[model samples]
Target chain A: MILNDLSELAARIPDGAKIAIPPSRSGVAIAATHALIARNARGLHIVAIPTSGMQADMLIGAGAVQVMESAGVTLDEQGQAGRFVAAVKAGAIRLMDSTCPALISGLQAAEKGVPFLPMRGLIGSDLLKNRPDYKVVDNPMADGPDPIVLLPAIQPDIALFHAPLADRRGNVWIGKARELMTMAHAAHTTLVTVEEITEGDLMADPLRAPATIPAMYITAIARARGGAMPLALEGVYEADSAALAAYANAARTAEGFAAWLADAPGIAAA
Target chain B: MEYLPEELLICTITRLLEGTGHIAVGVSSPIPGSAALLTRALSNGKTGVTVLNSANLQTLNDGAGELFDRAAQGRIGAFFLSGGQIDGQANINLVGVGQYPQQDVRWSGSFGSAMLYYLVPRVILFREEHTRRTMVDQVDFISAPGTSPPEVYRPGGPYALVTGLGLFHFDKLRARFRLTSIHPGHSLEEILDNTGFGFDYEGEIPITPTPEPDRLSLLRGPIAAEIADPYPKFAAAIFKS
Candidate 1:
């Protein structure tokens, strides 16, 4: 029932926890991202289920300790290391060579309290054989013939996201209401960042609420004013080119990030 | 099959795209990438066409989301699509059978299947091989189709089928497959090794011209030239971070 500050909440999730963060652009929960960046945490392995090519690039550019990335599209127009390329090649990041399926499948597995979840995507792709990190366990519930794909449970210590609106009880709304719905539902502990955090106004038009990320499922509800929505919808503010530039430079490495942090004292982009 | 269908698929698709009065494409779609590049090369980049790069940033001139809708209002212009699997009636399914549906599959097969297929006069179905598998008797699902009946879309069916080994087309009347061209260095037997269905061969299947390797190099080079900031910029951001 007690809401907290953004930086204060992000710091609660101890370092070295496998964190799941949305990539740049599409509905990426930026309030949570800034929370992480603001904390100046290190050795955190972040999983990014991508949306915008540019935004994802920025996460790597800024400082996503490890990227469990997949899907969307190959954003390689020039094939040169933007920020992601430089990071991966330098061993600053590891290539998952997987997509959205991996991210979602893993989450669902964790939510169900099961060892892994069976998914149908990525059958023929070499991703099955190559990634030693992902184990394909055989499904016991499968029918007579074919082998099913079992994705390992991904119980990231925490899940941070933003909803369009929320009530005091933490009822959430995902504007167009996307798989983000499932993600919010699956995380063991959920934290929501919202544009409007009001119970009176939200409950007034109760039917207008998106999915309610029940108060019990939620840990913290913080309000960060003018949070960046890099790929904000029609009426929303466009992606922050300035903030992205700052992250782009700062996230080069832990050391480079320290200097970038030293410079972040009064830096704020609207 | 490292870049197996690169050159052959590029030339075949672009030649079919010869008629697009105005065209726009996505990032790194080798066929579209090459077609757009070739189309621009043909006119020396003088065409009034608008290009949409990977970043969803429209270059030349055009608004977001309007590109797909614009291509629908056409005659004889071409749209490029290829998949690991193709069934009869051509409804390609890129996304998984059932992944969260919306945000589940990253790049679901053909987003605007009938939406554009119905509007565009010619929809070229392309892939690297003709194996009975890829060129199946009928697709497991229809992601996009060349034609449906009247009170429907363009029943004319697919305009062209470009494969790694050869090319084929749907007969306007029969709506069945017809031999159109054979790629160089590939024999009719090699072609037969690919397709799963049967089609009449007139023995006049022309040898498709192999595009110069110089052309394919543009995938990461000067030609691809940041049509959209989404792709390369996005990719760079991902790996580097």
Candidate 2:
């Protein structure tokens, strides 16, 4: 289904929904995120595709997140994610600290419809001890005693992201961001905001089909021009460093963050 | 013929990455990314360089999971990792300080370090900050352990540690870092004073070699322009003439 506006898409993501979002470098649904915050959405469980950045920070700062599971959350060159740090320090949100591959493995298991997937590493690391769900067991194939970590499948309630293009049929052209496909496959529903909605079919073209996610996986699509502002969309545009730097500076304090959020272009209007 | 400290670090890192096949650099790593690009430039494109999140640099098509998959297959030769607190045993703590869940300080979670540290053949532990607070006797949490048990399926671990003060190689068998060379302006006393963890050092530690004139020219020239794509601020600040 095609949503009329960003808010309509945001409205689909109910409070306490387990939503999977891509990393900052990948296409991030910043506009949709703003809309969600504007609607005062709460108790969101964010599952970062391995890792995340400003989008996650903003959501956490807005008190929209109850749980955050990821390998890391950083602002890249901008500096530390102040809001996330503050939240973690305050014990505001439950953090499921995981390694990058472990998250991917869990998601892959869900995509493959498996109960769990066995992975190497994480033997003596503290991450294993902290995570009760991850179990270390002897590999049955090994002649000797070989220990490996088993990760349970992670199936999110929704997969949300932004992309460069999508068709009227809800097929999304992700280009090189294949992780979105993994997220879409691992989630119960996938929502996307795109720069433009083409009239024709995106999957019909041979060249574009390879990089396009079929509409079957996508639950809804919303046309959001420049949706990934402040964050880059790979081939579409470069990241606005000055804006990101401003956000980084303003998000340092709760008051500053609130002020910044209120003054943000779309949030006030929303 | 003068060079910046970043250039020196890049040169040192480039030398360490001399014979490695494909070098993969993580996010927020300008110095290592520059060095990997430099190594590739020096090798005339023989060495593969994959800088995560760079449109121009990344060659992977299968997305984020491919990097880990390649590492598991032993395709990635070298990788870089850093920590909030590194111990004598080379255990890195990217999680936070104090206790596990409720900690006083929290840096970014353990990125790909846990797997990459174990998968990548040569994992260079890089931290620009060298202090007692950053380097500890034992980490509050082991994000990625320095060494695994003998029966564990581990092929890669910490190869060396590079800081602003000096360079130290990790002895995995002994599970300790040995002081290899101190940077030109730094001293053994300074290192000993600043470091919270103990290390092995023999007789007189040699000063780390500065970047030669040719290497400096390359760093200030094509390499600087190339690195500007991913880390424009760093390139502009360091290479601004």
Indicate which candidate wins on TM-score: 2
Question: How accurate locally is residue A203 in candidate 2, as Cα lDDT from 0 to 100?
Answer: 92
The share of true interface contacts that also appear in candidate 1 amounts to: 0.02
- Residue B92 lDDT (model 1): 50
Clashes of each: 48, 0
Which candidate leads the pack in lDDT?
2
Residue B187 of model 1 has an lDDT of: 85
Give per-residue CA lDDT, model 1, range A1-270, as digits (tens).
Answer: 436667666667776666555533335555556556666655665554433344345445566456534443223332222455455445565545444445666766776788876543233333444456565444555444344456687777666665556667666655433445555556766666666677554434666544344565767766654554544432345555565555545554556655654664331221
Give the CAPRI class of candidate 1: incorrect
- Write candidate 2's Cα lDDT for A22-62 as tens digits: 98867999999999998899999999998999999999999
Best candidate according to DockQ: 2
Provide the overall lDDT of each model, using Cα atoms, as 2-decimal numbers. 0.53, 0.91
Model 1 earns a TM-score of: 0.52
Name the 10 consecutive residues with the lowest summed lDDT in model 1 chain A.
Answer: A72-81
